[model samples]
Target chain A: MSQPEILNQAFELGYTYTRSTGPVVGRFLTGLKNRKLVGIKASDGRVIVPPMEYDPDTAEELSEFVDVGEQGEIVTFAWVKEPREAHPMNEPFAWAMIKLDGADVPMIHCVAAKSESDVTTGARVRAVWADETIGFMTDIRCFELV
Target chain B: MSEEEQEMITKVEAPVYLKYNFTAGSAPTRFLAQIKKGVLAGQRCPKCLAVYIPTRGSCGRCGVPTVEEVELSDKATVQSFTIVSIPIPNNPIEPPFIIANVVPDGANVSFIHLMSECVNEEVHIGQRVQAVWKPEDEWGYSMDNIRYFKPLDEPDVPIELIGKLTVTGEEG
Candidate 1:
């Protein structure tokens, strides 16, 4: 095939993924709907953020629900030079796993900063909200560096 | 259960539909486009002679780019098959359908396509089959171009001869 002809044949394939989150994730979303940041406390008393349905260390279902502070400290993050499809932002942004106050594990989300250099480990950030809110993760627009 | 009660509970009309936008990635787009024209195309790795259905831009084994475009035969053999009694959500086909791994006559890879014109018990490994194109009106650049594969009258081709054609990447 000719170059242009072959190039023309190349097109994008689309797919829709419908994931069924188990009870723990379902309960977490329900809590988020009430504007509550819920965590599942592990057996050792480490309250994990964005409550893990299954404990990574124990491989058991987490049952305890602990309310964590909405505010948190930036644990670590990578500068997303080019955000992939379905990411919170289309433009340049920073994705960080923030360990919320009173929570042990970090949660992944975008951090809003003027530039990558502006974001740093241990930076204090707070959740920003959209004008309208759904119970989904996108409800928190991004963390603004304090 | 009383017949009258059963009849009363059975509602005649049920409407179920799912709406979502699908984006085709790079490799599948080429495969779909060829389906629209009723042509069989496979990706040929220049270095290893591996031909892939649902052609890939690069060779998985050699990790080099495959530049050759090889037109393959529609005739293929059924390596294995399953009667799908449980339907996967969002798929175009309904349940109780036959899906088979069809290894085309001159390619290393086997593609999963619907099997038609045979009883469930009639389907077996090494069964000869040929592509049955959908009506011209319904043709598009997708695997849907060939509606399904049906039993072919040609004698069974040997595994050694079939193996000669470069096996493309693994089954999808």
Candidate 2:
């Protein structure tokens, strides 16, 4: 007839650390700070956005950097109907695999849209830069449907 | 662009934070209900007949369901313990406190709890201890109902007979 008292508590797990991003990743982050997009040349000559330090197939050290376009097409996406507190977007959004212009490989990022119907495969989207561009992935706030 | 803006970034500080709301399960809820009344309770496995305080709803050794309820004694014996010198992150308690793994009479399993009101260096295996509970008004569905354990005046149980005691506090 009466509800039993249940035990509950809020818990927080944290980790704080500093690390060196080395030349390749550091260069890509630096490009974002400068309001530019950078990609690396793969062994097969395909350009990879969010550049890799080495070619995955040949395992060769990659040094060539190519400037890629800010606009891209969504390859696929998962729509978040109910956003959680940890999500980048408070409102409903989509985490999409985007193929930027001039880059063969697609990068995963969040996209802001009015509704799930607004997002589709091959939908064109452009990067929305933050007011202050720091050398971090958050420099590009989120992509918007173009 | 400024020269500093053109300079390459090398290092980054990444701090991660996670939050969650934890809820107690059925077995613990039953145990905490009794704990709110200043009692310790456990579940006994049907297959192994081993009692566990704050029961896991199943026997760890026998893999059988521990459905039979058994009330345990607040008096316990220190099976093992550690005197910490380094402070834990975000915890209010300072260093140099004793944390012990204590097996209560009638329970085959041991649980961790703070040990206080005794010389840290003097705390040893098979030491007899009793729960030092907080005020009745402050009691809730939490292990914190007992502030800490203190040394009891009773003689220490032998090291080999630590968890092998009956409900009446006799050798099992």
Query: Best by DockQ, which number?
Result: 2
Per-candidate alpha-carbon RMSD to the true structure: 10.5, 4.0
What does candidate 2's lDDT look like per residue over A5-119, in tens digits?
Answer: 6678898897766779998999989999988899999989999999999999999999999999999999999999999987899999999999999999999999999999999
The C-alpha stretches of model 1 lying farther than 4 A from their native spots are A1-25, A42-46, A52-63, A75-77, A104-106, A116-123, A130-135, B1-79, B101-112, B117-130, B134-145, B151-172
Using TM-score as the measure, which candidate wins? 2
DockQ of each: 0.03, 0.58
- Candidate 2 TM-score to native: 0.77
Interface RMSD (one decimal) of model 2: 2.5
Put down candidate 1 lDDT per residue, B28-114, tens digits, no spaces: 666667767787888888898788887877899999887677777888888779999986756777778899999886677788999
Candidate 2 residue pairs that clash: none
All candidates: TM-score of chain A: 0.84, 0.92
Candidate 2's C-alpha runs over 4 A off are A1-23, A78-85, A115-123, B1-26, B44-49, B57-69, B83-89, B118-123, B152-156, B167-170
